[model samples]
Target: MPISDDIKLGHAERLLAQLRESYLQDLPNHCGEIENLVLSFDRKDPETVFDEIFRHVHSIKGSAGTHGLHLISGICHHFEDHLKTLDGRFEKIDGRFINVCLAYIDCIRTAVSLFEKGGETLPLENELEQLRKRFLKNNLAGLLVSSSNYITMLCQQTMGDLPVKLTTVDDGFAALERLLQQKYDFIITDKELKQLNGVALTLAVRASDSVNRDTNIIMLTSKMSIDFPAGLAPDEILPKNTGLSHALVDAVGKIFNGK
Candidate 1:
């Protein structure tokens, strides 16, 4: 009989775990190189260091998806796209661009900590999001996919400072419709949603024919043992814990900037 998909995933995850160690080991070295590139960037051809950084993230993007680290790959995908848009014109690699580059490296560094130990070292989630928002040309339009009034309030209060146009849905099916209907810079969801659960809604959004398929997603959940469903990855997950307000705000802020 053919192996069950679950079994295959189990095997794949084990392999990824082993592979992760190697990645974690090499991570600091890669980060150090990026730092050095930034420090020495002024005297160098901007394109040279830019190409190196692009290729660095490009490599990670490939390896991560292959190992089922789709969350990491997804973040890198957006990061890589940002760099690709600035492929040439070596003159734009200073100031804000430098911060974006350094921040991307830091995100990669934080990624390893997540799977290795439940994200204890990922203190810069807010910082990460803020940088993304600052650099992106338009960081508006956000969707709050939750049935809980509390979730909306938390997210709204957290993101009140941002200029994002917010839309809310208490129904997962409606959330999916909204996602397909228009583009959103960010999506914040809860796991215990009605009509459709958040993870399944996310999966549907990911697999659907929506133009906003690549929008940054945050699974704001209170549950512990829930694994991300197969072939589906949310860009980030914020626990509905004591820090929910801060975390949601930071994550939402990263994807859009009305500033």
Candidate 2:
């Protein structure tokens, strides 16, 4: 005999309930550990604590989504993104970000508690969106490096209304120097950059001790080839075809939304 659809559905329901219950029970302990990290953040080594917090929040984010708790998952996603910003600068971790993380954890805990008690998650869509906008406005900065002022202007126009501030540099070597002297959340480069090409610039960024060593990079090129070396990887690649501005803008929107 084979299991019927109804039976399968019943089994899934039971499994979901069990998992949700387990998560609810463990939520406090998880939140407690995060709070401890927040309180003792000044004393502990930053990289270790950041990695640890990221793991715990990431685990919750994954499991929350698995159990149909999207509110928790969404919150964790943004929190995880913020945590990544502290990656190379763990030693100089920002206190404001730490407070924000704690506040997000609190929000998740409260939401989980409400859902468990009433079997319904309260609506927080508006609140969450406001919080997201606030963080986006304050937390993100990026760079656009291209020899073409036309491309730079298009990018600037596209990003003008968005949350991040985009800085433009005319040459690749200058961009590399900026990477060393400052920090940015992302960089967009043209393949034919002056002073140094895009590929060499990426290689330099990866090898340098700049705070943005792992900064997100996007490359624009008129041609694509498989023979390009493996280490010169950019986060995204856009073809410099007609209407490249729209394509670039769309990709940037998606990237920002994901964060």
Candidate 3:
């Protein structure tokens, strides 16, 4: 007889608990190593030190996901992006940058401590939000996957007045790669992209186990009627028509307004 799903789930939960335990035990050392590396920055070989710090944070993010510490993984994702933005600017690695880097490391440490104490970490989450607002590109992140200039223009016009940092990709595969690595507030995709169509991309996003599994997806299609597969339809589908701009604006408004 086959093992029941409940039994399988029980086994998986136990294994995850063990992994989390191990991760919690080693998190301080990981954070300490990162902190020490940052504090001991050497201008003689900035590239080497930067790469080392990146690698450590990258490892911590991946491990956090494996151990079901999604919050830590999310924070690390943003921190990694923050680091990447400063990669080539060696001179920018000054007091402000150092302070931001230290704050990120401390955020991870606080998260771990709160988790161990079974305490509410919502305030820490808010602090991270405030930090992102000050140091990162935008408080909200968005991805736009479209090959149409008109669509791109409309999206840009709509998102210009908002506090969203939009990243554009012309292909679905590239969009998928971004989705897997980062968290986004919403995604706007074209239905007839060259490599991957919008429907197929939506299906992939919905089925993915990444941070963006439930992200809002607005699909733009030239066709008036599309038979989307069950359980794979995008949040909003707008046809290519005269009112597209208005519809797109409304869609973006609802998304930002949390409607």
Candidate 4:
């Protein structure tokens, strides 16, 4: 049976929302960890560096899948495969290899930014495919859930009465795009997302046609020193360690009442 376009869009929105929430809630630390690993790779031992890179890419691939960034996850899968092939080989880690790795990181960064921007069609599909075929020949395709999944699950459990949609994504721009198409009373985000980050996402939402016209936004962050990004201000920023539920409810109420 042909699926209704409405249903498809609705499902896509819900999924995207979940992804946005997931990445916003996590990803920062993950990206940081990968960056650290890359920097820590042994310059004298290409094999050791390959191993380190493999682990970092594997972790990213796993997290990307869990958060529903299938494209990002797929790209990481390919990168990981490339590292695996060089496991036992004593090849020099040339500038070209570094460039490819940097490109992958750039892609991941772009993907993260896109999610906060409300999601956009990615342009790295061909590169991702080529890298995947070249690197992950023996790898099996599968999904991996991330910690953000648990956060969203908690949100759903707690806000059962509110008609809220949650999504996970590799790009905040894409999430913003999805959010603009719908009428959401409130938007909740975390500080640690990949590309756009929480502050960026909030600003993007506020600047968006629907959100800028009028949409309540609440930012959740583990950091205590989060500041509003330039040209973007959120309605509120709540500490993740504090009373998250209370802050969210209060923010929503204030926005709804024009306070």
lDDT value for candidate 2?
A: 0.76
Candidate 4: stretches off by over 4 Å: 1-20, 42-48, 126-259
State, as a TM-score between 0 and 1, how close model 4 is to the true structure: 0.39
Alpha carbon lDDT of each predicted model: 0.72, 0.76, 0.82, 0.57
Candidate 3, 93-150: lDDT as tens digits: 8887878889999989998988788989779878877776676454467789998888
Query: TM-score of predicted model 2?
Result: 0.55
Candidate 3 regions exceeding 4 Å error are 1-15, 42-44, 137-140, 144-186, 190-259
Best by TM-score: 3
Ordering by TM-score? 3, 2, 1, 4
TM per model? 0.49, 0.55, 0.64, 0.39
Residues 37-139, candidate 1: write the lDDT tens digits.
7777788877777778778777877777666665566567557545754648666666777777677777777777786777653355455456556665564
Local accuracy of candidate 4 as per-residue lDDT tens digits, 133-252 = 333343322111113665555554545554332333445655554454333345666666656666666666667665233555566667777666565766676776647776655665
